[model samples]
Target: MSIKDIDDIVVHDISKFRPQEDISLDSTKKKIVEKIKLQLKLNNTSIRKLAEKTGMKHPQILRVTSGENYNIETLIRILDALNLEILIKEKDKNSNDQLMNTAAL
Candidate 1:
């Protein structure tokens, strides 16, 4: 069964977890980098291991974890290696509300 929702409270749909109105690209990139580092530590995973899993070199992974500029494909590969995926959500102009394209990854 599905969980009950709180009255008068707006929440993101569990079936479609997404967000909109993201910050600037640079800021988002920085945030992603920070999150990756934290996830690595929390999961007790290391950059070297990630490098091996993604077929990337340790130095490149270091550059990514060190906050150096990286390409989007590289980011995707890194996250994929970590068993993570990125979601993209957009705002609906007609309804003036956020819409999540949670069809599938």
Candidate 2:
């Protein structure tokens, strides 16, 4: 059964989830980061544990969670460790929000 309309989906507490360092990201990057944050929350995993799994230090994961750094390789590794994968698909340009919000991480 369909759970909800894509446009109706909401991710709660992304901004308040963790202490972030001062970081600047364009709106698209910020949306991606927020979706990643949501995925982490959904997986019930912590950055420290993810670090241990990925052989990366806490600070590196912290950059990802905090939006200070988002090297694609780093994100891919992190997502892989979480048993997640990215699937990019074409969407209507006017429907960017739903496309990103419903991205399969």
Q: What lDDT would each prediction earn against the true structure?
A: 0.73, 0.72
Candidate 1 — which residues are off by over 4 angstroms? 1-23, 91-105
Q: Model 2 residue 49 lDDT?
A: 85
User: Which residues of candidate 2, in runs, are more than 4 Å off?
Assistant: 1-25, 96-105
65-89, model 2: which lDDT tens digit per residue? 7767568999899878877778888
Clashes of 2: 0
Question: Best candidate per TM-score, number?
Answer: 1
Q: What is the RMSD of candidate 1?
A: 12.9
Q: What shift in Å separates residue 29 of candidate 2 from its native position after superposition?
A: 2.1
In Å, residue 24's CA in model 2 sits off its true spot by 12
**Where does candidate 1 clash, by residue pair?**
none
